[model samples]
Target: MTTAPPVHRSHTAGNPDLLPLLGRTPLARIQADLPHPHPGFWAKLECLSAGGMKARAAMSMLSGARRRGELRPGAPVVESTSGTMGIGLAFAGQALGHPVILVGDCELEPSMRQLLRTYGARLELVDRPAPRGGWQAARIARLREVLARTDDAYWPDQYNNPDNPAGYLSLAAELIGRLDHLDVLVCSVGTGGHSAGLVGPLRRRWPRLKVIGVDSVGSAIFGQPARPRLMRGLGSSIHPRNVRHEAFDEVHWVGAAEAVDACRRLARSSFVSGGWSTGAVALVSAWAAGAAPGAVVATVFPDGPHRYLGTVYDDDFCRAHGLTATAPATRPLEIPHPRAAEASGWTRCRTVVDPLAAPRGEAPAPHIPAPGGAV
Candidate 1:
């Protein structure tokens, strides 16, 4: 007997699925175990995206660019990322039948690397810079080199590109339609794209709304001296031009332990497994929800925790980093201390601090040598 002709999968199934395989993540009215005044606050579950948080917005931006003639058909796309954005670009490029080249620093997680390959992106690993110098300089240098040598390659420079923030603007618009009024929007800052992009549109619609920027303690973005940080996906050693400081009403500096604890709390209570940055945003949101009492707070859960299974979620790793227990719960409301004012560059609200809070001003000073030849 002749065997039936072999069945074939859809042509589209060869690549990592894009919009068709993705759906809008639910915006839940968090009530269980969360302290909030308006009965509940909305939590945008971004982890439900096909490639999680980054893929959802990245695909939208790339697709929009293609439709708007911003990108040539079949042009290869190149980007530098520590993780999430690269994964998103990989998936988006695959869906559009374009090749992707991802330049990543050595700090990239193994899972993220595997995901990029699975989505058919070529990964180029760059060496980590010297201690105290960090990877930003090295990563940018490598990206520039790759872009110069590659032909017909588009650099979706997420850090500086207007489209980066524009992508999040779409997300904010979707959120506004679901919630009647949002008192505050909390998000963790890396390139500051998400917060900067969302704040512009949301503020135009709701002038009274507050945008809170959460940053990891060692990140230079909020003005700390350049240093290694345990937290990933939030906080940067270099200033990203796209960060619109004026759009933020307040900023909070969180330590790694606090972020990890918050992540665990979210998992236990909401069944939401989130990355370190998401946990930091969630912690800030919970604090704001408690402090404001009658106000509605909304926050973005950037990505799922699976990519960080070897670090943030591992008890041994947490202990090794000296982040073994939960941090004390504190309200988000702030009464500025004199020391904080003296140390922080910009002073506005009691809770407001300069995004670049180190002795340096909001903008990064040119990498200059000090009198004694020190940085």
Candidate 2:
């Protein structure tokens, strides 16, 4: 054997750079006894990313903007987010030499607020929900006000920007590299970037792949009536244009209590769990795996548990919100169409339709700024 060269230690403890660690998150097999006993499904542990899965989108959006000259060097980047995307944009801003300004609503978790500030992003809070749209609308409205004052500010409107989904192509490549074959893909619907972005490329290889979408019970994305939603990271009051309604083969609406139950179960059994979106997707994924024995079902856990300690992981918070650890039904109640009736709990619909296509006012239109120019 040849002799090895001597190793040397650097003066610094380690590299402070976090940009290089953005993707290729670990995929864990989740086969919990509580939800469904099957041959276990795989979960893309996106929570292990530097700032959750949306970090991929954020970096792509900003980098694309710079290449197209839409974003000047060192200019401020502004957008509206609930929590996850804020963390993503904050991380991307630092990586690309841009200052991020995020508009969030009053109900944003304290942990998320502190984390965004710590990342050097300026946070603006909207006081109340809009009469027509909701917190999402209120946040976007406030975002416009901030954009109006800042010079050369670029708004990578995650709700409508094509670049948002385009960013996720790398994630699709990662999945293909790891798994030999995939049957079904389960994803939580929010701005609809990841699901819409991923399915097209994945389908190119697995042409018969089935895409299952998970949304909040009160979300209007799948044609349910809009109500005050407690869960974040999935579901939307405003119908985001980024959502490709035709992409989903089936849709499932998951409630707060059911999500909480799955989250706790996954944490206990598999030792890997996340927040609302993670639990919601996991519940549906288990059912999908059970429905077709041997089918390779995969889901994405968007965020980790640390940010949800005060809400999803806290006993007092669960009690206050009437959430319980009771396990969800083995199978979801089915509906023929999205608007057959308003879903209140764990429900599924096979015929998915674009809510905006029904009528002019069926779904609330997003109040996003037009692209191509600064405010």
Candidate 3:
């Protein structure tokens, strides 16, 4: 029989009060018979944390800044976010006694806007996307403007911050404590914090651990062109430096309709599903579990579904976005390289490369084999 990991304050030396509310999120097993019969995947329900999974990253960044004197006592915290990171910063700000200011894009949901305000964060929205970087770059530009005027302000640049990924070490420990063996670890690539953070520690214990990264269809993260992306928690218009290109054994791109279908199906079948990132990660994880036979697979559900009610769960919203409950392909279409072709639906690539380092259509490095020399 398996036992739960022990509950404790955050490993960081931050405000003891809020740290205790952040860790020890529940790990659940989700089994489905759809398309085929195979072992189910384990999901770390990060939605159960006080703010969300990124809350851990928020606190870690803030505490590290304070300790290093980059952020003074009672300094204002400012950053750009799509949604989830904003909520995390708000929670961390309140706990650490810093006034929080967030810059988001117009596409941010109403529910998330109100929740951030309720958490005592001052929210700003960018009216339009930048010419090259989409909403993310626009929000960052506005964030810089806010920082220029605000005195003694600190910006925890989640995308490139080392502390952002370091915050997830505790999460890795929890997974290690619970699972005796793990074959595949699936993660949604957003700012690349949690995936980068978790893999190092996890691989130390299980050297042959397979890491699969899930991203949105239009994201530029895996050499795909940036398009207007409807999904929030995963994918990015600009590539983040934090993405450990060499760490992943394979990469999967999931479309909005596919994610929506996966999320609704998961809610009905397991009663414990999350938002966009969760849905995308789950879809890929289910496929991985099915293909690998008895291998143990695990994934993280970034946030709860409540904030996505106006978007992912609403019938009207789904219709407007042309989303439906259509099931995705049972197996992903395999590609030789990230730029082999533009992936529209569910697709996978074995040769993962850092787009910045390798020019387009360049031969990618050899695949990093998983256990038993299979990718």
Clashes of each: 6, 0, 0
lDDT of 3 by residue, 1-375 (tens): 122122222323335587789979889998853334568999999999998999999999999999999988777888999889998898898788887888898898888899998987888888999999999999889888888777788999999999999999999999999999999999999999999999999999999999999999889998877888999979999989999989999999887777887788888888998788988888888889988889999999999889889888988999887776344555677778877777777778999988888765665333331111012
Backbone clash pairs for candidate 3 read none
- Runs in model 2 lying further than 4 Å from the true structure: 1-17, 325-327, 359-375
Backbone clash pairs for candidate 2 read none
What is the TM-score (0 to 1) of candidate 3?
A: 0.91
Off by over 4 Å in 3: 1-15, 33-37, 325-327, 360-375
Q: List the candidate 1 regions with Cα displacement exceeding 4 Å.
A: 1-17, 31-40, 60-70, 130-133, 325-375
Ordering by TM-score: 3, 2, 1
RMSD of each: 8.7, 11.0, 8.5
Instruction: Give residue 340's error in model 1 in angstroms.
Output: 4.3
What C-alpha lDDT values do all the predictions have?
0.69, 0.85, 0.85
TM-score of 2: 0.91
| Model 3: number of backbone collisions | 0
